[model samples]
Target: MGAHRRKGDGAGTVPVGGGRDRYFDALRALALVRVVTYHAFGWAWAGLVFPSMGIMFALAGTLMARSLERPAVTVLRDRIRRLLPPFWFWGAFVVLAMLVHGWMPGWQIVYWVVPLGDPPGNAWGEQAWEVLWYLRTYLWFVLLSPPLLWLFRRAPVAVLGLSLAPVLVLTFVWQPPDDRFGTGLWDLSTYLCCWLVGFAHREGVLRRLPPVAVALLSVAALGYGGWYALAHQAEYGGYDLDDDPLAQAFWSAGFVTPLMYAKARFGFDLAGLARFRRLDRLVTVFNARAVTVYLWHEIALVLAVPLIDRCWEVPAFEAHLPLESQWFMFGVAWVLIGAFVLLCGWVEDVAARKPPRLVPGARPATPAARMAP
Candidate 1:
């Protein structure tokens, strides 16, 4: 979530009007960390632990709604401008790698630039680039936000209440085709309600809701989502919510609702973080390089494997480090991720029209006011 001001705002929705909204900033940082951890380890339970995609979309939706206060065209342009450069910079490497591996070119290749649909990839690039699905879905959301926000504002409660209908309809009435278009449709529907909840949060609709009602609704959604995921694990091959969009949608709704509402209703407190300068700075860096982190994490993990294998050959590393452990790989992945952040993260600064830095949130030689972009 970008930022909005409200009295009594503390944990989840710190007002960005005065400064950075540390709460949402931390959520995004944690979500990005979870995404990398899940992919690195393939933990089925991780989805239940944290529905990162839903949370990310909700955060983005909140930002989008806040941005829509300006001209829609301008907002859209700024968003695309912010998104595409980083993507193109990342895609250039992946696309070039795919071409070197003999990936044939076709019109679908255009998606590498615009990503209106899923970008084509060779087998070697699949794992590294499959995460592009989120980018594609986010692009779609950005494209659709103008109309969605319009309808959402007219009857915020009613529209937000019924926002899950598209996913429900897609789940039961008709299944999407097993193609790129279907993939996009399923992803869009799966996260639509979360996105709308973001809108509600931005406009204070969530803040105004009765606490008991919000809690009950969240419980119902979580209960059903959990039950559905568990019951259908066999059919889906595992209980990962990502494998089942309906469950993910419901689970994310349940999980994210109270969180968005709690900022105003209960003031989930995070102000103590100010006492830990280094920890606070890490959170700031995470938010600043979110795109860079997301784009490079898979490759980082992939690189971690061989590096770990080489380490196994070194007796010192082999005896001292748990080189065989996935946890160890997770650690190595972050190290590589940090390196990538240093090398390529400047694209984000350029996109944001800020002075480029090797790492975000590093103390400047001279003290200067830190402001949220």
Candidate 2:
């Protein structure tokens, strides 16, 4: 998504200027901010409040559906091209840092080049590498999207239900497997529902549902998800969604489905003059550099931890400061994120085949202009 269209415009359309939607750009930007904040501060409520990962997958799914208008091979090639460059850049940096720190490079290191599975991480890069699961999962989704889309188009409800069945079984009937591939597959099963919901959205299937029907389904999903979360709270050690995969999956579906309905019914509009223009530009920049920001923000936060700790160690600062405060770390994380964005954001521009800019400044051409030759 980019700030190149009005809220209700279609995702895949090719207009005179880029045809990205401001609503999606803003949502994605907010997701990026929320994820970075949640990671830095350990905010338990963040998952419940936003379900950022689900939203992100849904957004990607919509874009993927749009991309499929072209040949599937072309779409796959483009997806890999756009996705892998930034990953390769970051992976190379991580590898270099690990090698310099005396970690031996081995066969597992090959995973960095093509991270179909989670790569082995050294002590220095473990925190940074935690985010790679998304990359691996996203890669799988992209590879599978053509067939998935075909299945979705043929039988939307059946495809959607089938996607969710694995999660339900693993959550209730069968124990989820403990191996890395098994867990990764389990996670994929969970998010696939959200992704297919996105496909429904792109194809106008979601919009066809009566508002009452949407609301009722949402309530049922939320109710079951809530019951599951409460029942399994002890199993998870707390209300932390990350610890309970089933709850996380159900709750995310509950949250994302209704939001998608709302987005269709009443788009996300930045109201008023003062806020709109400022937010427009900010969202533009964020969407343009989203991949870079997402990939590097954790590393920034990890790096900032020592600086914050050093600050706490200062005798003058120690007594008055709450070193572990989430707000405090959030501020520090943003600063570091800004720095990292400036350093590496050009890669996103290059990957997108757009001219490199520190920030995106182009605005969507008007509808009339878009209709012009």
Candidate 3:
């Protein structure tokens, strides 16, 4: 994921130490923290403040475009291998748990294997498994990227517009389908533009734009998003952009554009933290174990719910606490999340083919010596 350097693209060259971007790592680490924190607390404003999903998809798109320099099949295989092992580990555990709790094993269970669509879940596992929609969408993006890249290289603007058109039509002009598969398809359509923006970033299209044009585009997008949010608040629930797919698409583009610009121009500097080796190690661990963290955090939250509820049942604890308070529950969730990471995070290493370590450094691994086939 741009962890290694490639020959071309001087503008995007990796910095001295090993070609890793601390800025991207820091951004990703922050996004992960925000997503976990928001999910734990159900903070509506958090979605507004940080469009974490959009930022993440954009980041993945940049990496996918970089990987596309290799054969498309190789890229797809490598991406799937990196993704599926940890998912399978987690999915298998959850499914078995559900089965033990009396869920019937059936043909639909096969969806858990590839998960191109959302897998069926029992009452015992539904909340914990809801996040798989992201993985399913990501798989589709990876599958479509080779052809998308080809089109982007040929006609960048047309391709981007085409990617964005469906979101506008679906959100504004036509009614989106209400069923599960239709809803999933609509979600993919809504976010594909953000993904394409990543492709644009890798292609240096964003960097090439005039600063004024970039700023204008960002402001216009945000303005439209704000208007859309306010206009639809009566129909939807609140100003939360997540309720309005079109607003989310617009707002996310606006939110990510400037950060991408800053990354392209200034990049993140860690020289000031030259003495903070432990902090550096923590960031490395967070980035390396990101998939593990994302996969398990929700399950951790679900498990924490009972413990927090028990605290509420205690007379002394209930006396001072508001019935709606989730602050303590949020803290408990992070603790469990950390515990899960330590217990099973090694699967991410195995999936990536990296040697297992609690914390990995920023260096790229040397290629293993090969034997003649």
**TM-score list, all predictions:** 0.93, 0.86, 0.86
Residue 300 lDDT, candidate 2, scale 0-100: 85
Native-vs-model 2 lDDT? 0.74
lDDT digits (tens) for residues 108-174 of candidate 2: 8777888787788777777777777777778888899999999899999888767778877877788
Q: What is the total number of backbone clashes in candidate 3?
A: 0
List per-prediction Cα lDDT, in the order shown. Answer: 0.83, 0.74, 0.75
Give lDDT for model 3: 0.75
Give the poorly placed runs of model 3, Cα more than 4 Å off: 1-17, 268-275, 309-325, 359-373
For residues 238-276, write the lDDT of model 1, one tens digit per residue. 788888888888999999998889875676647777789
lDDT of 1 at 326: 86
Q: Which candidate ranks first by TM-score, i.e. highest?
A: 1
Rank candidates by lDDT, best first. 1, 3, 2
Kindly list the per-residue Cα lDDT of model 3 for residues 1-373, writing each as its tens digit: 0100000000122333555576766667778888788777666677678888778888888878888988999999988998888889999889988989889967777879997877887878876787777777788889999998999999998887677678888766887556556666676776787888888888888777788887898898888877887888887777766667787888878888777766655554554443687776676667788888888888888888787778777898788765456777777888898888788888888887978765456555456533323
Best of the candidates, lDDT: 1
